[model samples]
Target chain A: MVDDEELTPLHPNHVKVLRVVTALATLPFVIVALVLEVRAFLFPGAFMVPVVLAALYVVLRIPLRRYHARGYQMGEDRLRVVKGLLFRSDTVVPFGRVQHIDVDQGPLERAYGLATLTVHTAGTHNASVTLPGLANETAMEMREAIRAHIRRDTM
Target chain B: MDSTAPTPQRTNPLGMIALAAQGLGKSALPLVAAMFGLRDEFSGIALVLVALAGVGGIMAVLAFLRWHRLTYVVGAEDIRVESGIISRAARSVPYERIQDVSLEQTLLPRLLGLVEVRFETGAGGKDELKLAYLTAEEGARLREVIRERREEEAVAGVAQEAGAEQDSPPIFAMGPGRLLRFGLFEFSLAAVAVMGGLAQQFDFILPFDIWDWEHWMELVAGPGDWIAHLGPWAQALGIMLALASLAVLGFATGIIRTFTREWGFRLDRTPKGFRRQRGLFTRTDVVMPAHRVQAVQVGTRFLRRRFGWHSLKFVSLAQDAGKASHVVAPFAKLAEIDPIIRAAGFEPESDTLDWHRAAPEYRTDSMVLVGGFFVLLALGLGIFVNPLLGFAPVALGMALVLGEQVSWQFLLHATDARQLYSRRGWLVPKSTIASRVKLHSAEISQGPLAQRRGYATLLLGLAGGTLALRGLPVERARALRAAVVESMTGTDFSELR
Candidate 1:
């Protein structure tokens, strides 16, 4: 799914948060296997070993790949977000159609000094295009520029 | 902030009852399920009352919080709403960006002297920022304020561009008599499908259930082995005849609903935009401003096509009575539809347009997309049940593939400087005319195979929804995309907003 043009990649540290989230997701399966082993069921190693490998593969490989795959660009009057590795999609949001903008930071994101900038548009398809794993300062600048552009466009 | 006027006021307290009543109705099923499982049939009535009270009380509290949290502030250049009970989100809609402020009143709300205000900002799906409980006067005042703001913007726009103002007069009216005629041809496959599904689910409850599948299956089991008394061809014929009759029955009921919904249908063109007043009992009114219109579509179903009748709908920034689009002239001659499209700012093209056909590859793509379903179904039925049934399906699938090929021959799309034109579909051909200025966005996509074939599907998203022109050469799609984007670059959307 590689394209001719190289896009602006996401922040490198995003893979760390994604890894943690995916690790927590696989915790239940590991717990179930541990319980089964303690109960003297057919050795949990049989299922747990493969499950751990799969979970580890998913957590370690997928996040870094996805992080590298995600990218966004600020066009003259429209915002372009291109993402996905296998099923790639390119979304364009014209400045005229934008209703609002939001900069969001979760606890994990805040700790990393990263934020996600979302551009809200009127179109049903691609209603809100989010540019994730941005430096907090860059996110603020983008948010301000979007608001200023909206004001200028209205005038 | 404006204490003198109190712009944002609570709705009539009676609206709380209406809210509670709606909540109670929604919760009644679950409450009954609980009582039924408890096996206390005698205490059902008491349980229902208690449950209803619980629902009502919860709704009343939520409604009060919602009302308390909701407030509209009309600023000089913007209108701001501070809403969400817990989240406390603030949304500021610039004055020029607000598309339409829709006012609605249902029976209960109307009786309670309360109305709902929906602020639409041209976002297609769920465009509403709704305040469900507003006093009737407050709703009217809010609408008036927005109207005045729009007028000021329009006046300023007119100063820049002269002769920019236009109005649509009453072009079509469907009286009670015409509604009856309209209902007769309202029969669609969707109606049959819905009725068929409902009958399948609830047939056992009916006293006289002619559609009882179990009884029909038992009767069709046939004397001795299957197909002993009746031949396979005869059995097939019987099934076909029964299906045709069921379709006819469904259409009959669909006609009734059509009559009820469009009894008082009326369409008129005002200086500002197109207005539709319809519905027999509810009497809904919708106004679509001329500038706000996104695209105009002229459609004809198979039945209506035979009669040279067409329906015209407009995709506009304003929500059309919370529907996808507004049906300006539901059932009319092409002569009638032409003028309506013209009013939406397009010179109506001739019926025999020199359309640009899709690439020849579309025939194969469509066959795989559509005929593959029939082929798979046939294979499943043949392998799982009867081998003879398999041959019929293969033939049918081949026939479907043939149909797709024919449809592909007719699949076309073209664009001029002012507008984009596309005529698609085999069974129910729909011609769409979208103003280049109203173009929302464009997308070009190709599968791995299609990329190799050098063809892709180009989707032009307008106010009217996406118009997909499939099987265009990759170069053509890219060129078309560039052209559309160029046209959309500096297009002023003040009107649509």
Candidate 2:
């Protein structure tokens, strides 16, 4: 039945992690724009610096919106992940179908005490569904839960 | 030799020769081309001959080293393969993990009574293990041993009977007459294209410049002059005759291609599962277990539909020659294909299905999007290029829009208690029937426009292939997802086999 259950958001620290990543990714373009503005190559104006800053400011705020857009609902025997703004995707993976579970941490995620949980299924497309930005402990607990479910089903 | 013992055994000794010969054959084309190009220079010819000899020697030595190093041990729990002259890499696959075992025989190996055995693990292409040039008898025995071992694991303490090899009556077989008709529908002009490409590639060998219009004119003058003198009616007749010949050539090429590919095609239901054997020059024998099949696809072309002909393919965990789905019946009447579909534990689609069309808003939005793009192109062309040329795009756009409407009419989806069905396409209609229990996951996706239009696309995850039901109302999409997830969670997958 179509139950309207609110999805649980990621750890609050993930927003800080996303913000740092966004700024790091945008640093190069900001520097390039500043250099071009100082050189004043083809077009002579003080507009390039201001335009680049405005773009950077707008992009730096996307991480928060992205974090807000992503959420997950762990059902009794299934996990539902909803994400994306422009192109929303709601995926449901039943515990019975999961082939394996993984809890991995990237450099930034480890720094923020966050990890990514991935569930691999036997299907070719969408064979692995990843839900990132979970507290490291939570990720491990979820992995154990799914593993127990798989073991019980096999038994 | 004990079959079940963990003794490492080498493949047939003759495989060394076969591997070397195969390597040489691969290089023969370039070697011959180089020799031809250097025919005028004595030193160049000598260089090419020496190079050929060097390559042949290296190939022979490498093949011998490879055959010597490679060995397989059919252990009780798993099959281990060790190879790589310098690296010494060894890999083992447990019997339970092997999805299927297939045998292939190219011309040279067939003549030598050898077959290439492939063990598919359902882990994609790179994971499959292959043993080349084994005796045909040995290959078959090995396949049986693996099958029995897997079955033993699936049903503990139940020993399967061995060496039965009983020939069951084929469920589907294509005779010469049936193949001829099928070939007629496959008319193609690829041979003409191949000839043109060859002529262009080796134009230097021609006495005249093939691309020079003057040369072609001169060559045709003899025939052209005579036709001109015969009168206008005779000229017209000659042109008609030439067109007819081209059509005949296309049909002949198609017939030849089909005959070679589908010669002696037969499909049988064995205790192991479905066994398909086909091909004229390079025969292949593949067996797919019924439980490994995730879905069934029934497809037909526009003309074939009118003739009641359809093709049946199985979306199985095991890959078929790099393809996601295995062709069970390439060309058969619906009546004939129905039995095979049923044999695979799938029911043929009946007229009583509660088919639902895609949301009206989705169709309208798509039409407007497609039509608007074409209209803009037409405007740009009319303003920048010739107005007459612009009219062509507008006409093309109109035709495309009409096609979209027709396809939308045919796009329907339905679901029964055990299966999910989706049918799409107008010219080449394809209907997929997937078992709910076999589905790994369900995804509901919506692009920006679809979100505003209140429709979503539901993609069902199958093992080898994917089944998508597009343009469903968002409410219905969620409902379907709930239904599919319920069915998936209710079943115990371990009991499938």
- Top-scoring candidate (DockQ): 2
Q: Provide the overall lDDT of each model, using Cα atoms, as 2-decimal numbers.
A: 0.72, 0.87
Model 1 CA deviation exceeding 4 Å by range: A1-6, A15-68, A152-155, B1-169, B175-177, B187-260, B350-354, B357-363, B369-385, B445-464, B469-472, B492-496
TM-score of each: 0.67, 0.92
Best by lDDT: 2
Docking class of 1: incorrect
Chain B of candidate 1 versus the native chain B: what TM-score?
0.71
Clashing pairs in 2: none
lDDT of 1 by residue, B1-497 (tens): 34235365454567667777667667777666655655564465676676556567777797777667777677776777787889988878776666767666676776777877777776545545667777877776676677667778665554323123224336787777677677778765676678779988987877766666777677656552466466888778878998998777767766778876776677766655666766644445566778767778888888778878788888764566567778888888888778778877776876555578877775677788677788888889899999889888788888888988888876888887877888888778888887776776565666666766668777665654666778887677777766776677576444455
Write one digit per residue (lDDT tens) for candidate 2, span A8-115. 999988888888888777777777777887788757546566766776776667888999999998888988988998899999999888888889999999999999
Candidate 1 TM-score to native:
0.67
Q: Give the residue spans of candidate 2 off by over 4 A.
A: A36-61, A152-155, B5-7, B28-58, B84-87, B157-166, B386-390
How many clashes in each candidate? 1, 0
Model 1 residue B91 distance off true place after TM-score fit, in angstroms: 15
| lDDT (tens digit, per residue) of candidate 2 on B282-377 | 999988888778999999888878888899999987778879899999999889999999999988888989999999888888889889999999
Clash pairs (backbone) in predicted model 1: B168-B269
For the second chain of model 2, what is the TM-score against the true structure's chain B? 0.92
Candidate 2 reaches a DockQ of 0.69
